[model samples]
Target: MTKKKLNFCFKGSRDYIHGTDIFNELKNCFNDSLNYENTMLDLSFHGIAKKKLDIVEDNATDAKVVVKFYDTNDDKKTYYLVENKDDIVCRYDYAENKIVELSKIDLDLGKINLNKDTSYSLIENIVALNKSLLENMFKEAFGKWYFTRLQLKKIPLNYYLIRLEFKSNFNFKLTKTEIFLDNESLGFIYFSLV
Candidate 1:
């Protein structure tokens, strides 16, 4: 049986829609499947994921993510790349490249209920937000995550910005990624460093 890799898709985004990060995650997972050196890696995020797995690799460049994905059928695939390190989300487009895919994303803590109160520190707030996000996604998907990489440019940030990437286990990218969120969750905010 093929194993399922991790995927990203859940609730808590005002502008809820599948972003590029998910695409890149899926792209890397696909690549790993194509090149399997370890038989012990019987399971990789190959397709339809509900679990999350982090695949770290070497010699990866802006053209490819340093991570790989494993699927439920024990198959592996997916690739990733980042236009800039500050970019948070990844995108995918199979027709654009070979083996792996790429994308760039920026996350903004835009107008939300983050609060003007000094009760929380900046780093604390960011980490807390990250924790909440991780919890929310895992809760909904049963801790599963399947993503792919694409070439989606971010909306552009006002000040400075950051970015990240991921890949999937598909030769071709998926149809779409849909995100959902509440207003206070700050899930709708989107931006890029450019």
Candidate 2:
């Protein structure tokens, strides 16, 4: 008898599909076969900066939200950030299926003018609008596990990033799932089980 191998891959996106719509796209990626054994899941968002802010001081030309994973023999930590085009976010050795190096860059919040009235309003609205759907997605993906922390960062006139960390009920370790949003509205959601 021969064993069969399964390959899971999903890439999708659309305009005017922000909050729950994006969540639904993710939910459908697995086609009702999401593996609950994975211990952690991280979601990163990348989008165009709204025109209302002053972003010239930062000297940033292009930006994207990316999640870099550091996988050690013992543990793994997910680092999510909005990266400028000049920055080297991380190095991946596809043959080994792990990240070789991760370079961290701290954003100069002082240089960019973050309008108090509108800072993070986009992400805040998306999160607020899809809170329940996110909760349900977490439950469906992790079973007894729950999300431990959520982080949101706004890059004035560039991009924004969101990170969601999930906690497992048991101590077992496995490859974590990562979802990357390549663009804000006309975005591409890339899901990888590894």
Best by TM-score: 2
Per-residue CA lDDT of model 1 for 33-63, tens digit only, reads 3433232111111232222333333223432
Tens-digit lDDT string for candidate 2 (98-142): 111111111221011112232333333233322322333333454
Candidate 1 regions off by >4 Å? 1-63, 66-131, 137-140, 144-194
| CA RMSD of each candidate after superposition | 18.3, 21.1
**Per-prediction TM-score:** 0.18, 0.22
- For residue 183, model 2's alpha carbon misses the true position, in angstroms, by 34
For lDDT, the strongest prediction is: 1
